[model samples]
Target: MFVKSEYQKKLVHVKDVLSMINSGDHVVSGLAGAEPKAILSELHTAADSLRDVSIITCLPMGNYEFFGNPQYKDSFLMEGWFYSGFMRKLHANKNITFIPNHLHFASTKRLDYKVPRIYMGNCSPVDAHGYVSLGLSAVYEKDMIEKADLVILEVNPNVPRTFGDTLLHYSKVDYFVEADYQMPELPVTEPNEKDKLIGKHIAELIEDGSTIQLGIGGIPNAVAQALKTKKNLGIHTEMFTDGMVDLVECGAVNNSMKTIHPEKMIAAFALGSKKLYDFINDNPSVEIKKGTYVNDPYVIGQNHKMVSINTSIEVDLTGQCCSESIGVRQISGTGGQADTAIGAQLSEDGKSFIALYSTAMIKDKTTGEIIEKSKIVPMLTPGAIVSLSRNDVDYVVTEYGAVSLRGTSVRERVKRLISIAHPKFREELQKEADALMIW
Candidate 1:
């Protein structure tokens, strides 16, 4: 048989892919937008025949039956590297657990402990050369694919053909399932007033020719808006979003002045609208490298004037930031925040900024009342995970203003942090600080 014909024999129906599952097998899937829909959506069908099947994923975009149904508890358990709304709402089921790691080592650490039995990744169709592009992400998918005992590619036409370390030969795959499903897209809305002000403050701190790392959020979207006026900015971000597309199209990010990976936009994954997927397709200037290299602090620091812009949920007076959780409950993973923050700080003139609104409007789960709480506090909530340490947080930006705490004492951080807090909470925060002798 010709090579194409030989590889063609691997193509099977989606149900056939499900039959490959075995009891006590561990499975890994691609990140956010690259999540396989048809296969994962029906994995529960095979659960009755299998037991102790653990699935590892990051920011899964779908409410799959395996995750949405509690009946699969004994059959399947999902371990997510990061949590979004889809998995966060299902955390109470007890089948979903969180894995804490920097983006660079998310898969590396896991493999050292347990190598997965299977890897399922979304990919573009095989080309004439029998190569398939690991669309949407190479974050950990590429790594897991190399280690898994069985490799399955869910080939979808909607998947953008991206370049970089994402290409895989057909000979390496055990099976191929032709799946027709819409590619997942993360909705990008316009930033609100508070986010815009925070963006302005962060933009002021970034230099003209700096390389920047940005992730998803209103603040990052706002930062991209405010940065349109900058010149020669380069991207070394973890997620490639529509905001980066805006910057590039507007002539703001030309990648000409980057010290590392100059003239190319490097990211570990792509998660945005169809526009973003279209922009990266067959695009040579953009590279979807694996998370290990893309999010490595040392690699990110090689870029001159590296700036890391991220958002947080809450922060204490000591500059300790909790970006991924609410008290003991895990809200998100400690993805690239710690990675890029420390990496940017390692650069010669790099800066890291953690931006958030001074207060958050939270609906009381018990009383059904809307309560506004200050994000800057004298101390963190009990059991809050410190996603970014005090020593790693260089700049803290709120709508009110920005403060630098790189080498500040606890007392100074307390004062500076309070000064930028929501006005209604300032007096209360100061009183609490005094009572605790935080100063």
Candidate 2:
């Protein structure tokens, strides 16, 4: 419709684009569903011709061989901001390592370390006026594309065209590789009985007209179901999932009472079911923004009665939460756990919640027996990294009950947290706390 012929000159096959890659280049792939599968899937075919190429990825949807297979270690090294199962399983291969960052500063921090040589992502077909939508994610893709030596995008008709900062002029992108594929989808995670109990407790804490941020998991979905009866809720989050779609369809999230961006849902990126993609297609009510602004504490604090809900792997008596690790083993990334928690606290009358199960089942290494271990402990596992510090924790919920620790003293926090732990481990935790003289 607008300058179509002018942009068509830049079209190229995926193999031709791969020829531009050279040794010692820094390649950045799109986030989540925005990943350019056609280009990435064939990257390894050219790997034998290159050497020492570094790649930066965030929440990759598919496991491309460049980083997934240890055999390609000599030619490519993966530096990820966040990891999926494929990357985590190959972490010990020595070709992949985590690049620690907060969601808001992921792009900025990386550029400070090394500028990108190439930026690749998925986008909707060019529209009238010579513009293309970045589609599913804006998280940090836009930031990388801005300064990369080359910009190549997979033009997929199946990608949902979204609004806000997801648009880019055709002239800015170097090449367009035609693609025909369905966008990746994640099915809804059904909540278990324990998830429902924790969800109900959290639902009771939220007031009407409140805005909320939800992380990925059954607990968040349960929270979504629990909030179905609420009126005029709003969404301002890092990752928008299908649960939010359910809330909107149910009329619970009208966004009418938001203090900022009223009547619209704001997010950095989205991931979930095919239904979720269709709901956001050309939807003016949904805005896909950059992670720098969406996850910023000051920006997130502008919402009315903001509520941040997230999950954890384990929590200690003093309110420290190890969410992304098991001892020294990395499971995920810090993501926006601290960002949203602090931002919600900054909002007037806003609240942040951390939820988890009371206990976990573990096999005893020495006796070969299965036992129930408390997720609530006097101290974190020896090498566990603290995802959320004690100062930022607000409310914590478990199947047994919920506890609030805002402005609470150390001794009081110990008591409150232990009270909500599984009954079988309460006394054991108390003795550990006393022996350490931590409270």
Candidate 3:
């Protein structure tokens, strides 16, 4: 192990160390809440002195000067793996580009194209053995740090000391900067009536002792809240959240019956409140593995009775799911929706669910009036990207009801799908289905 004095020798001012970045350098930062705020701020400040500096990021939680200021476009480019609200707002800018990828293969595939010159992220304080934890996110930080030419880290005490593949030796890092900023918190979204209804429908399908995968949002949160009555439920998910913590505390998730990684909650990354951070800090039951292993379908299938519940923007009559986009506009990238959905189906008694509200309020362009429109349309809007294919979907759930599509013909699918659609739209949908000869 490297000595603490040797590691301290490499510590330098954030601005001075970032000044090492040359023009045309490809840089990658720690994603989400794990992003090194101090170092990235310096990079943004130094952008005027550099040109063609491409920064690859995903689910950026903070609004930094680099992304917010249009003047820096000539010097800095933002390439996103997943579009957060900030990235979506910057979509019209020429310097902003979205990279399409599956969450499981995101880091590995990006490195294959072009290895980053710099990999920097925030980490927990160094331990007595000269080891530091990558804090909350281990999604791709470890992979990027291993491939980058220079590795930098910001030491933050607020970051929780998570276990699994998140530990790094001081010797592997080339530079360190002190950062005392608080980790960004994703507040828990209370489940609405519709969300709870949908949750009840999905929860009915989940069996006791089932290992579960949940995405982030009101729907997933509602599902977690609804599952409090379940016994011995386990978690094998991509992103951990506050809701999962509630399950554990409620005595609902003991992980006792999990077929893989028994008695442990396995996840790739986590984002939530300070309460969630405190729960994972040095907790023996939680393991933060890499995305490559955690989100892999084969690994997810190893857990018997796996149930993956993911939200979607819309679904067509054929069961094609459009979760990431609305027509040509990219709202978000394809994360682990397909990964865990397919993986859950591969489990011996697993089930995959796509949940969404039956109706969405949209403003009419011509009339300028807000109207409730059916999300379960006769056909998806033109140019919508299918995040999950028809064959891969097993169950479709709406606040109205839940329908199974597996081994069903197109006619049966159309009828079953229409049954769960908002009642006002069912008549029109049935008429369209009749015209299209779907039934």
Candidate 4:
């Protein structure tokens, strides 16, 4: 009986792996922090020989040559589920496309429509049992790998070995490429005075032992900082970050009262600095699961006192939130905002909060002058996409105050939202509301 080790059999050069990728094959890369840089770079280098190859990804962190140069457009096309700053710039290209989806069903919907031919991602070194962990991100990688015909892994020692639904046996992977690239870091946001005020208002609404779901950015970081004094807070978020790590260290989040996955920080993915990676590496306190379960409204609602804190770019008086876009321009995708907002509201004692600055400084298109305008408007800009409908909003918080919109009439919502607007814009907003006959 001759049985060779799978690792030796699967180990191949980057060019060799690229040679396996046929033209017109659908390729799905890993999500966020788990993206396979080496393999992707090789794919870009070999792009001249391929044609109509589609590269599908979500929130890709680094600036890769493949996406940086537009010359490969004839051979490759890029599709994003959620746009990063780099991807947003690439939107000028006609070949790039965006897929609108809720976070929970992102993988399932794509799979149902078209199963990918190749799945490439980064993973931790093989463990004693020949199992590799999908480190940092498990969002849709698990589902994509299962559906793809060929699975390729970039073995990176720097990637943390996380537990839960991300482990895979060596036999499952068709090829391997060793890589030693530095993991991308998401810096900690310093909360300004306005952010601090908003954080304080949001923190007041959260009681001790509440299960919280927080997205990334300055506002969520501010909220987490505000909750430092609370006790027994549990984390059930879609993306865990450095702020959550701080909460856990401060003894504010003990995960003691969660109805689901009690005593464990439950998340589908993580993106942050090296410290966050070190914290979750082989740490039994953290459990990274699949996005299908982590972001499911039904699953999130099962937790007691679930409080979801998210941010919005602009909000209308009627409670419609434009979080994913600026007017008709797509700044980002609708990533778990609707899911967590509605799910937290579905809980027995849950509350969902949409927080943003009361006003924004925008440059006048005609005059090229920067002007301060109200973000709480009478109506959303024409062509704006509503990430969260009026019916799903529970609490709307600004630096001025926080107002509950749940079960409120249109007139009542207008008044409540107006009270929290920037003092300078209150009068103008009132006049607009009057003209619209909303109050």
Query: Against the true structure, whose lDDT is highest?
Result: 2
For the record, the alpha-carbon RMSD of candidate 3 to the native fold, in angstroms, is 1.1
> Candidate 1 lDDT, tens digit per residue, 1-439?
1287887799887789889889988899889878778889889989889899989989998999897889899999999999979789999998999998999999899999899999987889888888989988989988999999999989898899989989888888899888888888878978999989999999988889999988877889999999999999999999998999999999999999999889999999999898998899999999999999999999999989999998999999989999999999998889999999999999999999999999999988899999999999888889999999998999999999999998999999999999999999999999999999988
TM-score of 4: 0.98
Query: Model 2 over residues 65-175: C-alpha lDDT tens digits?
Result: 888788899989988888888888888999988888889999998989899999999899988778899999998999999989999999999999999999998899999
Give lDDT tens digits, candidate 3, residues 167-238.
Answer: 999888999898899889988899999999999999998999999998778999999999999999999999
Candidate 1 clashing pairs?
Answer: none
In the predicted model 4, the residue pairs found to clash are: none
Off by over 4 Å in 3: none
Model 4 Cα lDDT, one tens digit per residue, 78-197: 888998888887777665778999999999999999999999999998887788899988889999999999999999999999999888888889898888998889888888989999
Which regions of candidate 4 deviate over 4 angstroms?
1-4
Higher-lDDT candidate of 1 and 4: 1
What's the lDDT for candidate 3?
A: 0.91
| Residue 48 local lDDT, model 1 | 81
- The local distance difference test score of model 4 is 0.91
Give the lDDT of residue 382 in candidate 4: 91
